[model samples]
Target: MTLLIETRELAVAAADSIVQPTSIRVRAGVPFTILGETGSGKTLLAQAIAGTLPDGLVARGEILIAGRPVQDLAVHERRALWGREIAILPQEPWLALDPTARSIDQVAEVYEVVRRRPADGARDDAVEAMRSLRLEGAGRKLPSELSGGMAQRVALAASRAGGARIMLADEPTKGLDAALRDGAIDLLREAMGSEGGLLTITHDISVPRRLGGEVAIMLAGRIIEQGPVEDVLQRPRHDYTRRLVAADPANWIRRIVPERFGDPVIEARGLAKFRGGRLLFSGLSLTIARGEIVGVVGPSGSGKSSLGDLVLGLIRPDAGSVRRDPRIAPLRFQKLYQDPPAAFAPQLTIRRALADLVARHRLDATRISDLMRRLRLSDGLLDRPPGAISGGELQRFALLRVLLLKPAFLFADEPTSRLDLITQQEMIELIVESAREEGCAVLLVSHDRDLIDKTADRVLALEGSWMDRDAVA
Candidate 1:
C-alpha cells in the first residue's frame, strides 16, 4: 500500500481560525476516518485538503497527494486530478446534482467527459452503477423528482463512476436506510481494493466501526483523540468521544411504549398513493392523536416520506382522504422537511426568514431568540444564507422555523438524519418535549429501527409499501 494523501499541520481559517492545525495520513488499502459532529470543523478540514474551500477562507500547511505537493500545483493542475486520481462526495447530496438533468445523464456525464469514455459506453456504465444501488427505476427522474435517499444514491453513483483510486466521502450514508447504507459501505470497500485509499468524514459512528480504519475524534475544531477505530469507538479517552458513543441509539435504554393519547389530530382512511409507476401503498389507514409520536420506518424508496406527505396533505392520496381536525388552523399543520435547504430561500439570511414569519404572523419577536437558544444555534449563523451553513445546523434552523409557528400536527421527515449521535438524541428529545407541551401530533419518519423504537409510541412498519405488514409493535 502507498500513501495517497497527507496533510501536515493543515488548518483552515476565515476571520478567525475554524479548523485548528491538524495532521493525518491516508494510505492505500486502508481507510482513515474523522468522526465529529456538524460545525465541529471536520467538514472544513476535508474541504481544505480537497482544494474546495469557500472564497473567503484560507488554508495553511502542506498537502501531499501521491507524493506530489498539492499546494504547489496550479489550480488547473490540481483540478485535472479530480475524478482521475481522487474524488469528493460531499455532505449535501443536492450540491453534487444538477436540477435540470436526469439521474442517468448526470451520472453518465462524469464518465463521458472526465473519464473520456464513449457516449454509449458511459450510459451503460451509469445504468449498471445505479442498478446495483436499487435505483434502476429512477433513471428518468430529474434530481428534484427523486427522494432524499434516491438523490443520495444518484450522487454516490456519480462520484464513484470516475473510478478514482482515492475517495473522500463526506457523510455518504447520511440519508440512506440501513440496507442502502450497508450497500454503500460494501461498494466503497470493494472500490478500495488492495491499493486504493478512502477517507470518510461522518457522524454515524457505524461507518468507521464497519470500515475498520484509523479514527480521529474531533471536537471544537480540534482532534482530541485518535487511534484504531476499535479502540476509539469501543474504548475512549476523551469525554466527548465517550459521550458520543453513549449517545448512539443502539446504546439507548429502551423506554416502554409512550402514554396513551387523546383525540385524533389527523387521520388517514383507506389511503392509497401511486408514484413512479408503482403503488407505494394501498388500503392504508393511520391516525395520529394530539401529543402522540408515531414512527414510520422502511427501506429506501419504500414510501416512508410519502406517508408523511399524505398525512400533511402536501400531496393528495390517489385514493381515500386525509382529514385534519377542523378546529386547528391549517397553518398549524407544518412539516420539517428531509432536506432543510430545500425549504428556505437561498438569498435570505436565516434571521431574515424568521423575521418575515414573525412580522407576517404578528408573533412576538422575543420568542425567536429563546427558540434559537433552545436549538443551540449560534447568533452568527442567523446572518448567513442557508447554503453557507452545515446541513446539521440548517436542519436545527428548520426545526426552529417550524416550532415558531406552533404546529398542531408536525410531519418530521428524517429531521435528524444529517446530525451527529450527540445532536440527534438532543433533537429527538426536543421534538418529544415540544409535542407534549404544545399538544402537537407528530408523524416521525426514520431509517434507523432503534431510533423509531426508542422515540415512537407505536411503529408503522412498511415492507416495500405493503400495508399488510403495518403492525403496531
Candidate 2:
C-alpha cells in the first residue's frame, strides 16, 4: 500500500483565523472519511487537498501527492490533476453541473480533456458511464432537465471517467432518498475498489458504516476519533459521535405520537404541475390541519417543491385545485425556499428586504423587529446583505420573513437541506415551535427520512406526481 495523499499539520483559514486545522493521510485502496456536523470545514479540507481553495483564504501545510509537495502548483496544473489523477463530487449537485449544457456532454468534456481524445469518443464514454450507473436517456438531457438524482449520477460519472486514482466526495447523499442514496453509495464503493483511495466528507453517520472503512470523526475542525468502521460505530468514544447517532430523528419519531394536536388550516386537492413536457403530479390531494407539521417525502423529482408551490399559489396547478380558508390569504401563505440567499436580492440590506416585504403585505413594521428577535437573529445581521450571512442565518432570516406575515399555512421546501447538523436541528425546532405557537399549518418537504419522521404529524410519500396510495391510505 502507498500513501496517495498526505497532509501534515494542515490548517485552513477563511478570513483571518483558522477554520479547520488537521493532519491526515490517504492510503491506496482504502476509504478515508471526514465525518462531522456541517460547517466543520470538511469541504474546506477537501478543497485544500484538491488545491481549489479560493483566493484571500490561505492554507498553511504540506500537501504531498505521490511523495512530492504540490502546494505551490499553479491553478491550471492543480485542476489538470483532477479527473486524471484526482476528482471531487461536491455537495451541491445542481450548482456543480453546467445548467446551460447537456449533462452528458458536460461529462464527456471531462474525459475528452483528460484523455486528449476526440469529442465523439469522449461522448461515447460518457454515454457508457451513464448506462453503467443505470441512468437511461440521461446522456441527451441538459443538466437542468434531469432530476436531482440523475444529475448527481451524471456528476459522479464525469468525476470518475478520467480514471482519477483519488476521489473526494462531499455530502454525496444530502438530498437523495433512501433508494438513491444506496445506489450512490454502491457506485462510490465500487469506484474506490477499482481506483484505490477515496476520501468522502459527510455528516450522515450511516454513510461510514455503509462504506465499512477507516472513518475519522471531526469536530470544530479537528479529528476527535478515527478507527475501523464497526469498532467506531458500535462503540463511539466521543460525545459528538454519540449525539449524532442519538439525534437520528428517524429512529425516535417512529415510536412517539406525532404532534398533530391543533386545527384544518390549509387544504390542497388535485394539485398538479406540468413543466418541461413532464407531468410532476396530478390529482394530488392533501391537507395541513392547524398546529400540524406535515412532511412530504420521496425520491428525487417527486414534486415536493411543486406541491409547495401549489400550496402557496406560487405556481398555478395544471389540474387539481387548492383551496384554503378565507383567513389564509395570499400573504398569509408564506414560503421559505431551500436556497434563501438566492431567493432574495443580494444587494438589498436585510432590514430593507424585510421592510419591503412588510410594506407589500401591509404588515406592521414592529412585527419585523420582533420576528427577527424571536428567530434568534442579531440586530447586526439586519443591515448586512444576504451574501454577508451564512446559509443557516439566511434561512433563519427567511423564516423570520415568513413569521412576520403570521401566516396560517407555511410552505417550507427542503428548508434544512443546506444547513449543518446543529443549525438544522435548531431550524427544525424553531419551525415546529412557531407552527405550534401560532397555530399554523406547515407543509414541510425534504428527502431526509429522519427529519420527516421527527417533525411530521403525518407523512405523505410522493412518487413523482402520484401519491403512494397504499401508504397514505
For lDDT, the strongest prediction is 1
TM-score of each: 0.96, 0.86
Candidate No. with top TM-score: 1
Task: Tell me model 1's lDDT, rounded to 2 decimals.
Answer: 0.88
Off by over 4 Å in 1: 256-258, 465-473
Model 2 ranges off by over 4 Å: 137-141, 253-263, 344-397, 420-422, 465-473
Screening candidate 1 with a backbone cut-off below 3 angstroms (N, C-alpha, C), the clashing residue pairs are none
TM-score of 2: 0.86
Writing each residue's lDDT as its tens digit, candidate 1 over 222-281 gives 999999998888889889999999999988877565567769999899998887667788
